[model samples]
Every structure is written in C-alpha cells, then in structure tokens.
Target: MKYISKNIVFSVLVLSFFGISSLNAQNDNSKIEQLIEKKRNYNQTEVKSKGYIIQLYNGNETKAYAVQQKFDEMFPAYTSKMKVDLPDWKVQIINFKTRLAADRALNLFREEFVGANIPKS
Candidate 1:
C-alpha cells in the first residue's frame, strides 16, 4: 500500500508539471498571435496614409505602354502622371491617395511589364 501511494504521487507530480508547462505554452502562443495581429494592423495603417507617391520604370516604351494599359484596365481612374525627381527620360505614374492603393495599382502593372520596376507610391 505504501509503495502504491508513492507511485501515484510521483505520477501526479509529473502530470502536474506537464500541465503547467502546457498552460504556459498556450499563453505564450496567444501573446505571439496578438503581437502579430497588432503589427499587421500597424503596417497596413502606415501604408494606407493618403498623399503617397509611387515610381515605376521600364527600358522599353512598348513595355511601359503595356504596363500602363494594364493598370488602366484593372484600376480605372487610378493612374496619374508624375515626374521623377531627376531629369531622366523615364516617365512616372503617380497621384495615389495612399501607399497601399499605389501598391495595388503597381502590382497590376507589374503583371504586364514583367521586368518593370515600381517605387512606393
């Protein structure tokens, strides 16, 4: 009887330890998930600020035109003309309300241009 009680006590201790560890692990996971969601919301809000600019480029005029055409079709009335800071011949499209909006428009253009580059709008 003494030996049986000792064994049961040992088993209970081990189970208790594991249960406590599992609870801690679940709390940690919840905290991590909350932090991730907060970060995502913050990043999205930062990019969604209106009055942002975007720059896009391509070496070929036909390629540039193709990208522009795609943007026109996908995001009607979203594209606007802007000039690069320097006097380079490359034309810029701009006039987006938010960085996220610019990104959405640029992504649409990228599908067509393939190699064309776009800066944050």
Candidate 2:
C-alpha cells in the first residue's frame, strides 16, 4: 500500500540521519583528543614557576567563584588554585606559558582588585 511504503521511507530516513550523526560525533571527539595531546603539559614545577596571587575573604567562596568566572572568560586556557588559611582565602593563577599571557590575565583581573597582585618571573 502507498501508506506502508511512505512509512517505511520515513523510518529509513530517520535511521540514516542518526547513523550519520553518530559517525560525525565520533570524528569530532577524535579531533578533540588530538588537540588535547597537543596542549602544553602542566606539572608541579610549572605550577610553581610564576603567578598572580589575590587574597579573598575567608569563607568567601561566592566572590572567588565570581572572580573565577570572570577570569575564565578572559583567559580560558589559564590555570588557577584556591588555598585556605586561618582567616583568609588565597587565590592564585599561574602556569602561564608567556609573560604576555600572564600580564593580560593580571590586567583583566585588576577589574576586581588593583595593587601589587601579579608576581612576574
């Protein structure tokens, strides 16, 4: 019947679409893996190299999160860490591959705090 043929054709088209999408998804994932392999490897020594240190209020995760969000927006490739001490929280951003990159992030973060913040190598 015409109805049966039409239904079969529609089902075949949907199945084909899903099949093609799955192959495309796999290809995209492979490209991402290759790029990750190419990115710089971060180690403890590099982490200690040079960075920017900003002290936030104790238990003030809200501000840290906000600052992190802003920082990530400007320097999506940078790394950061948060340390807690007796009555204060310290946030440091480091492992920058170049001074220019580090300086750029420091300038952007200055939108929140300004002073002797960034530590240069």
- Among all candidates shown, the one with the greatest lDDT: 1
Q: Which runs in model 1 stand beyond 4 Å of their true positions?
A: 1-3, 33-50, 58-75, 82-87, 95-99, 116-121
Model 2: residues with Cα > 4 Å off, grouped in runs: 41-113, 116-121
The alpha-carbon lDDT assigned to residue 26 of candidate 1 equals 99
After the best TM-score superposition of candidate 1, give how far the Cα of residue 70 lies from its true spot, in angstroms: 6.4
- Candidate 2 global TM-score: 0.40
How close to the true structure is residue 51 of candidate 1, measured as C-alpha lDDT?
67
Evaluate residue 44 in candidate 2 and report its C-alpha lDDT on the 0 to 100 scale: 30
Report the lDDT tens digits of candidate 1 across residue range 1-121: 9999999999999999999999999999999999999988997677544465544553456545555666556657665453433433344566666556767766766665454455533
Indicate which candidate wins on TM-score: 1
Residue by residue across 75-115, what tens digits does model 2's lDDT show?
A: 57666677666465556675656666667666776775564
